[model samples]
Target: MAKTLKSWLQILLKLVNSTIGIVGISMIIYSMWMARVWQRHMEGSSDDFFSFSVIWFILTFLGIGITLCAISSFGHIAAHTANTHCLSCYMVAIFLLLLVETTLMADIILNSDWEEDFPEDPTGRFDDFKDFVKSNFNTCQWIGLFMFLAQGCSIVSATFLRTLEKRQARYCESDEDDIAPSLPFLYHPVEPLPCTVADLPGAPSSLYWC
Candidate 1:
């Protein structure tokens, strides 16, 4: 039963790691595309829809690559017997990576030309193009800042977990090595005591005969 449980757990971890990795990769690709679109739009080119897509693509790819590595490391930790500290490291790394991606998304969504109310132009000379660029820049900047903050939080959490695990391990070891005295009641035997009826104040006469 224990073995079965362990196997199931291993499978579950693998699935989770793989799913996250795939998602991370996809997000990076999408971010890159968005950046390109932004860049194209800014250059008055109809081929691109956004002017900041290049920057977005670069940042996203870097963040995603780190995230993927972290996830892979987590899978290794989950599948094998490793120090809890190592697992904690993997968790922190993955968290930071995800945080970056989230921040980028938030920035793009917030800064995009969603509010420009400008008509789309095939020739890139639309009056709304300037507004669109300004909006996108603001959104991207905010998103980058948010991503940094999220990564910081992830690092902090991971550090806390790591410290806790280390402390727990130390406590366990101390208990094993320390020869503390046990309580007397805990050491007492369960057998009944041998006693005479005469020793009891409430003993009956028939008990004394026995």
Candidate 2:
């Protein structure tokens, strides 16, 4: 029963990670499309600064997509194997991710001068980022909050699965202990059957024939 539950939990973990990965792919695709559209719109432009800024933002978004994709990949591995090390590393990575995300969100919500907190990019992309965030503040915040919750849920589920793994290991060890005492008896050597040419004075053949 415990093993069955663990299998189901692994399935759930894979599903959630796959969903997150799909979202990352979508983000990557959208960012690429936006970059293409912007490039086409500015085909004949000579504004280097603006072009650079747009490119920088596009790359930033692309990086986020890649990061998420990577996290999802790690999650898939951890789920499939249920290895202790993998699970522990995944939990740490996810926790750190959550911590950073929470911090950024808190800064956004609580700090009016959050823009000042972000370092200025050489290509002025930070200004564009600020504009974009301000324009889509509500949607961005909600999405961030959603991801925060989802990531937390993933960690919690993974932790539960880890505990289950430990329990399963312990159960196996106990079973081995119970079986160990009987192993010698179970595998004891058998007496040799009488040889065809060996006949003894006893009822059954027990010695070489004269």
Candidate 3:
């Protein structure tokens, strides 16, 4: 039988969900490394140019990434098992990530100047905004963009993918009914015996049982 739309969507969402987890975990690791580097540099620096709060912020962001990984794991489980409750939790996590990513993207687009932030060289050759992002944006920003897209797609697909618990229960019942062994009739009608020559008359007296 052909697969249902929900099954296809579940597959797609599971792939995206796994990608998000991997990317999120990588980002967390990168952030932690950066934080450690900054800490080591700050220890010997005479000038307080960079605050320790940056490390805290990085750690906080890493925490968010860890949370994303957890949510993605749950989503995978939900997709595999068709668990409605787990799917709901996964949706909630995707929505929250969507909110955060959207907010960050908006902040970057609204407050930051692409041209000024990435000024031209001495030859006055400047990269376009697209190229500027490719050359200048940090790993977190890039990963966040990817995460945003993945989560958005996942959320949309999940709406169609999440199976209804009641419907699933009914489907299970139907499958059991199909597989269950049916009992044959226990009370078959008794067939009447044929009349023989011996049963017809007194000749049957010796042959017939009392």
**lDDT by residue for model 2 (21-90), tens:** 8878987997787667666766787856345444666777788888889989999999999997898998
Which order, best to worst by TM-score? 2, 3, 1
Per-residue CA lDDT of model 1 for 1-210, tens digit only, reads: 544554554555455555555655665675466556556556754454433332433453557656665566665564454356665666666676666667756675787755344334443323343466577988856754754553454344344445555676887889966645565557878886675555556766536422
- Higher lDDT: candidate 1 or 3? 3
- lDDT value, candidate 1, whole model: 0.55
Assess candidate 2 and give its lDDT: 0.80
* Candidate number that wins on TM-score, 2 or 3: 2
Q: Which runs in model 1 stand beyond 4 Å of their true positions? A: 1-11, 23-70, 114-175, 178-210
Of the two candidates 2 and 3, the one with more favorable lDDT, higher being better, is 2
- What does candidate 3's lDDT look like per residue over 1-210, in tens digits? 224756777789889888888976886886677566556766766745244343444555578778878888888898887677777888887888777767766776797664464333321112232475577669647765776788888887676666444466788899888766543444556687765434556564545432
- Alpha carbon lDDT at 46, candidate 2: 82
- lDDT accuracy of residue 201 in candidate 2: 68
Ten-residue stretch with the least lDDT total in model 2: 117-126
